[model samples]
Target: TKPKSRSLCMANPSAYNYTTDIFTAAALRWLETGRTASKPFFLYLSYTVPHAGGWGSWPRAPEDGNPVPSDLQYAAELSWPEVERDHAASVSYLDARIGEILRELERLELSSNTV
Candidate 1:
């Protein structure tokens, strides 16, 4: 058998959007206008974060290539190792995106019914 590829989920190749933003936007779109008004919907939204180690561009050092939008906020944590800071930033970025989805659910008055 052939060995599997190392890249599980590569980052977005575009400069303007990160992978998280793309997935989050899709979830938000569904919550906002893509769902059927007569039926309940199930959204299986997944995110890639703290694991930006997936293959992509070299905007920063090889260890810092995750491309998370919140990376800059963690850049100030000088006491921690660079890789750790990058991981934290990725997680924080994911958290904010999830918050957006949750807020959208609330806005649509579906939070009480959603799991």
Candidate 2:
């Protein structure tokens, strides 16, 4: 098996600032460099926000109201819950990044080839 590599970022509030993470960025880079319709590529993408600091595992999470910081411009004037506002921002950021990947795939003519 390949060695497990990890990027350690403080999971606490506002620790994350960048819109795209190393994994996603790397995937996009790979897609950008050499994308072919004949070759099959698999990406196992996972995210932390909206899942981490979520209250499902423990009820106290929501009660504690741990406010997190998101992209300054993206997070400004939001209509979501205080604690989960960061989650919303995080999701949006991720969505935008994914959109970039999708656009690259389309540009490379790999969109129709991908599952």
lDDT of 2 by residue, 1-115 (tens): 2223223442322433442565566787788877689987776667555565653231222333644344345334433445465666667878887888888788888887765
How big is the positional error of residue 73 in model 2, measured in Å on the Cα after superposition? 24
- In model 2, which runs have C-alpha deviations exceeding 4 angstroms? 1-19, 54-80
lDDT of each: 0.64, 0.60
User: Model 1, 1-115: lDDT tens per residue?
Assistant: 2223323343433432577887887788778885544567778986766565833443343344554444556644334455555776787888999899888887777776653
Worst 10 residues of 2 by lDDT: 55-64
Name the best candidate (by TM-score).
1
- Model 1: residue 22 alpha-carbon error in angstroms: 0.6
- Candidate 1, lDDT over the whole model: 0.64
Cα RMSD (Å) between model 2 and the true structure? 9.8
